[model samples]
Target chain A: MGVFGHKTVSMTAKIRLYVDHPLGDGQTVPLDRDQAHYLFGVMRQQEGADVALFNGRDGEWLAQVTQAGKRGGELTCVRQTRPLQMPPDLWLLFAPIKKARTDFIVEKAAEMGAAKIIPVQTEYTNSERIRQDRLQAHAVEAAEQCGGTYVPEVTDLQRLDRLLADWPSTRRLMFCDEAEAGAARALGAAPRGPWAILIGPEGGFSVTERAKLHGLPFAHVVSLGPRILRADTAAVAALTVWQQALGDWDGPQSD
Target chain B: MGVFGHKTVSMTAKIRLYVDHPLGDGQTVPLDRDQAHYLFGVMRQQEGADVALFNGRDGEWLAQVTQAGKRGGELTCVRQTRPLQMPPDLWLLFAPIKKARTDFIVEKAAEMGAAKIIPVQTEYTNSERIRQDRLQAHAVEAAEQCGGTYVPEVTDLQRLDRLLADWPSTRRLMFCDEAEAGAARALGAAPRGPWAILIGPEGGFSVTERAKLHGLPFAHVVSLGPRILRADTAAVAALTVWQQALGDWDGPQSD
Candidate 1:
């Protein structure tokens, strides 16, 4: 989303709905039961009403409702009114925390412009199970709340060891290693590259995990400074540091 | 707070302790009931036990328990062990949140190397009452948890409007103004001086509050970036942004 707000004359609010359809003008998009119930029953959106829609690729568009049924709804894409606000080229990876904290991590990550969010299971991680859909919804809601046109895709929970198994060749990993002793490396000079920041759980990465990460060729071991931050704090801290250093946080971001 | 853990030490078992008393060699420091209970009851420190004491001044020192009691304790300051770890000149000025979050702010600030933590009352802020002692204890515990040698002083709650009135002449205020929108002003490029990072509350700083802040000549209006950050995340984000930009996160600290 651009920093400047744009005014749209949305009335009888089309209830900005998301459908699993290739968005285009005159293309009819089927609303899933959940979205239908939300728009028709919950929002009381009537047939022939106008609503906004957007996919990650399609810019925001105003759609006209074609059908409103008891259990379903359908709309035809009208026109793209706003360009998709591409998220920052940053990935947020972290061990899953307790329920609320995990949700908080996703919410903050989405609000902070993370292009993708990954939940990793570490050696000392207490929670391996993740509510991926719930987290994904949280991210969507965060984007909506922040007036962002882009929503970060939340990946299914994966083991840290496995994700590092055949690591992507191009993406660089910015390991937020808290137990830096006190290296005090400057974030000012962080190298520019495709970057992902990994935050450990509350107990922190086990020695074995840290050793594996430290030895990786593509990993850049960095400190969020000297503190033994809680896992969530480390996530936000690492994101901020990375954004200030390498992410599209400074200077003009190219759309 | 040295840049590296390179200044070698003849390794010894170290336990960072908090004493309300000002520390000095040959001075018999008496632990209050709380400290005594924490030392003897919780930590199981016995008479003649060795421990380290730091009072935000006087380098860390070896201390031996002279008397042990459930309600009271006494210790004799021994030789100075590690030199005082002076925190970077950073002040955390934040709008007070709910009880737990407010405590969280003070605790994280202390651990993250803040020299002082100030709680300010904002217009949209609902809570005016604060438990200064409890908040102070949280800071102490965070310092202990993070192995910090300095415990930031937690000042009593003051009105936000009032504190900004006498905005220090020498200190530069990095206002984490959400109003900066998507303007990517690299905080790293901003002038670094005696600094403080300001974070607003849940409802955010009021319009009048923002205008007053923007009007200040010494204030540097900077965005933590796109997406609306919750107050707590905003606090950590602002701090990390500062440490990466200006604070001691990367600079050399000499003994």
Candidate 2:
């Protein structure tokens, strides 16, 4: 159905929308006030306008704007356009740094195809507490902006020791170490399975933390070049390296 | 020799410096007012304080503060520390986006080891003009912060057609195409040679521009992943893929 009182018509242009509600043919998806403002007020989308919707569950779907209002709106599902293409089972674990840098890490992690985002508190971690909900919102925004159907879950702050205690033996960990500065280990050689990339804080890992990580059989320490990258950059670089090396970047179903 | 009036001392911490002046053993480097303030007022480094310095042409050097002043200062080279490690013979050509994002492209390019940075103007490019000097300064700052000895030159904005008209056949171009959303080409398979990564503006490339790029014999089109990354994130992701695939990230001398 065409918006603005026009007849129903097919559209090719993709206007991606990430909805928290379920999606299926003929299902009505409600939008919050902000989303309504964005769709109706900012983007000027009108009722009956075709919109792509993903609920991080049902794949991507073509939908029609059923009700457009200033305070709220609704989108009725039409048909599936693309399957729910989930990112690889790769997780990103890092120590929270400054507020902006931490947000940058989360945003980049979401954009770079991290399946999960975990903030770890280490001995040398500077930030004592993190606004987990805010960071998760940034991830959602990033996923929404990146045209990603799947949104990585950003978990609340967890202690490194506690998390490592239950570390999955089958999942290999790419430990980015500062001490191994010049050792540009080719991460491609590592076998791919469940994996996680662990990046430390700006001050780097403490001696005890380093020893524990090094002692882990699942940890494969890797260096991100010789230069010391800031925490945020390291997160992006590490994610890129991991994705290129063993993640879904080489797969045919990337898009 | 060490700073703060110390005798010959052993220092393990690497404090990188980027000076406009040439650097060599016994050579003197004069600091500007800002640098003087950073060293004296901020860092509180007094006379005889050891500092590492690098010019784009020269290798890194260990130097000791010779003249300490409020407005200006000087450091005399004591010994050669590390050789000038040049990044791969790779260039990054990207359309200028928002101010902060453009700055980010330059900063991450320098950190990820782009040998040259070029801003190209395309039909869909939003920014009418770019501050080349400011972007260049950001590159220099990135190099300094990342402890890189070489700083990539940031060229002024140029027409993409003109650049392609004088294209070097030996240099392979990795054109990041938005249309190839799902075809994640394996960049690792491409032969190593003079290379450049071309990232388009936020609006993406015009059809004519894509046709020109696709028609190039030297162009190797690649996809970052399934997600539609913003221009800035795409730049960093593309650079990481290139570096991990064929750039110096495989070499031992990443630092």
Best by DockQ: 2
* Tens-digit per-residue lDDT, B29-73, candidate 1: 988898898888988889988877877677667789999998897
The alpha-carbon deviation from the true structure for residue B122 of candidate 2, after best TM-score superposition, in angstroms, is: 1.5
- In model 1, the Cα lDDT at residue B150 comes to 81
DockQ, each predicted model: 0.22, 0.30
> Fnat of each prediction?
0.26, 0.25
Collision pairs in model 1: A14-A51, B59-B84
Please give each candidate's TM-score: 0.77, 0.89
Model 1 Cα shift for residue A47 (angstroms): 12
In CAPRI terms, model 1 is classed as incorrect
lDDT of 2 by residue, B68-134 (tens): 9999999999988778888899999998988887998899899888999999998878788999999
